[model samples]
Target chain A: QKEVEQDPGPLSVPEGAIVSLNCTYSNSAFQYFMWYRQYSRKGPELLMYTYSSGNKEDGRFTAQVDKSSKYISLFIRDSQPSDSATYLCASAANRGSTLGRLYFGRGTQLTVWP
Target chain B: NAGVTQTPKFRILKIGQSMTLQCTQDMNHNYMYWYRQDPGMGLKLIYYSVGAGITDKGEVPNGYNVSRSTTEDFPLRLELAAPSQTSVYFCASSYSMTLKSANEKLFFGSGTQLSVL
Candidate 1:
């Protein structure tokens, strides 16, 4: 199985709607979870990241992780057209042979329409 | 700051032809990586370097090779291009992976789109 799996969603929503992006991993050793935003033809930039499990909120974005289920999520509030982009979920191990390596998901394409 | 820069933004090569994708970073980061993104395949690591003169293979390293001759540059070379190698290549670097701060995140280049025909 792939280390990380995410829905390649071409998810479309109206402006002001709430958007939820999620990913699941098979490796329990993954301790750091991250979410990256990529615009068309542009490389990804870190949006937010959380260590271990729990919730982290930054402005209108919230990142949540559940180590028990190996699930991670990124929620966007009051989604705007500016928020339209591809969201990628990534995870990395804190220690071990894979310390500096990051496992990424296929990414979900989001479009917030007016 | 240029962060990370990749050369030959786009290229087309005939099968069996070889080429090199250039990547340079001004951040002077110790960690550098090359990844390829295919449709719905996410990003697969091709090679990575911890510092100058040191390199290691990642998930998919069959058709590609990399060298880190300096702290600022890491180049990926494809000895024999194949149609399967056609993908968007990205070069990234990070100050560290200690998870100490959000600033220690990977910064990616604009990407090099290569088509092997």
Candidate 2:
């Protein structure tokens, strides 16, 4: 089984709605979690990052990691049309400089309608 | 800075053809990686390197090889390309600092989309 699993969602939401994207993983060794946003024809950009199991907030984006349940989530508030993109969840272990060799999710394609 | 840069934005290859997907970074990061993103799938780690001349296999390393001859270059090679190797490949780099010490965020390149038939 894949270490990380996420729904390949083409989830659509109206502007101003709150959005929640999630991923579940089977690897208990993963300690670093991150969320990335990728627009069409563009590389994935870092959105949010969290270590261990906790919540980290930056502006309208919030990242939550639950090590106990092996789940991670990204919550977007006050979604806008520009926020429409593919959201990816990634995790990694403590492997020194290769620390960012992330295990990514299939990504959730989100379209924020205006 | 260009951050991470990859050459040959797109390519197509035959079953036995060989090619190199070039990646370079200007951030002076000590860690570099190569990942493949299949359609409707997450990025899979194919190979990685820590500093110059150090390389290791990742989750999906078969049919591919990588060399980090210099601090700035990490090139992936497809010696005998197979259909399964067709996918969008990405190169990423990050600093050597630990996450707890400082943010070891990743910076990625535009990506190289390859199709092997």
Candidate 3:
């Protein structure tokens, strides 16, 4: 199994609708979770970040991590057309006092239609 | 703060040709990384450095080499360009990865698109 697995979604949702993007990981040691948004021809930009199990909110985006289930999610409230982009989920483990390398999922393509 | 800057936004190279993708960060970050993104895939790490004079390989380091003589620069060199080496490369940096700011501190460069013919 891949360390991280995210659906390669072309999930189209109408504006103002709630959108949920998710990823599952095989490693239980992953302690830090992140969501990045990538526009066409641009680099991935950090959107939401959370540590271990819990929820974090920033404007229209919400990041959730469930350590026991080894799952993570990014929810968009009142989605908009501007939100169309590829969403990548990344995670890293803390090994002793050092941080391990980050592992990324292929990414889910989201299209918020107007 | 130009955060991170990478040169040669686009390039086309002949097979077996050698080149280096330049990257520099003004953030004074102690950690720097090189990653490549292929079509319809996630960014795969090539190499990373925790500090100057220290480097390590990530998931995909073959065909690529890197050096960190200073905190601001970490360049990736392709000794023999191959068709399989064609991809968009990105440079990123961060102060440190602590539990509270583990994933929050990273900053990325726009990227360099390279094509191997």
Candidate 4:
């Protein structure tokens, strides 16, 4: 199985709508979860990061992780056109062999229209 | 800070040709990585280096090689390119003060689009 799995969604939404992106991982060693945003023809940039289970919020974006279920999610509230980009979820283990390696899932493409 | 810069923004090569993708970072980060992004394949790590003269393979390392001769540059070379190797390549760097900071964020380069035909 893939270490990380995400729906490659070309999800379209109107401005001010709420956007939710999710991912699941099969690696039990993964302890750190992250969300990255990539614009067309650009590299991915870290948008949100969480250490373990629970939620972390920053402005209009929220990241939630559930270690028990091996699930992670990113929520964007009152989305705007500027928020239109591909969202990628990544996971990393903090232990011996897999220390700095991050596994990423297929990104979901989002378009927020005016 | 020119965080990370990749050269040859776009390139096309016939199968069996060779090329090098250049990446430079001004951040002086100790960790550098090369990844390839394909449609619906996310980003797969090709190679990574922790410091100058030290390199290691990541998930997808075949057909690619990398060198870290300085703290600022990490270059990836494809000696015999194949059609299956065509993809957008990205270079990233990060700094971690300690092992506990393994989750330190990564700074990425714009990208290099390469086509092998």
**What lDDT would each prediction earn against the true structure?**
0.92, 0.88, 0.88, 0.90
Ranking by DockQ: 1, 2, 4, 3
lDDT of 1 at A70: 93
lDDT of 4 by residue, A28-111 (tens): 988888899999888899898888789999999999999999999999999999999999999888775343478899999999
- Candidates 1 onward: DockQ, in order: 0.64, 0.58, 0.55, 0.58
lDDT of 1 by residue, A42-102 (tens): 8999999898899999999999999999999999999999999999999988874342578
Extract clashing residue pairs from model 4: none
lDDT leader:
1
Question: Which 10-residue window of candidate 3 chain B scores lowest in summed lDDT?
Answer: B97-106
- Clashing pairs for predicted structure model 2, backbone only: none
Candidate 1 local Cα displacement, residue A68, angstroms: 1.5
Question: Which 10 consecutive positions of candidate 1 chain A have the poorest summed lDDT?
Answer: A93-102
Fraction of true A-B contacts recovered by candidate 1? 0.61
Q: Chain A TM-score of each model, in the order shown? A: 0.96, 0.96, 0.94, 0.95
Candidate 2: where is the Cα deviation over 4 Å?
A95-101
Collision pairs in model 1: none
For residue B64, what is the lDDT in candidate 2?
A: 91
Clashes of each: 0, 0, 0, 0
List model 2 lDDT by residue over A6-107, tens digit each.
999889999999999999999888888889899987788888888889999999999999899998999999999999999999887867643545688999
Instruction: Tell me which of candidates 3 and 4 scores higher on lDDT.
Output: 4
Give interface RMSD for all predictions. 2.0, 2.4, 2.5, 3.1
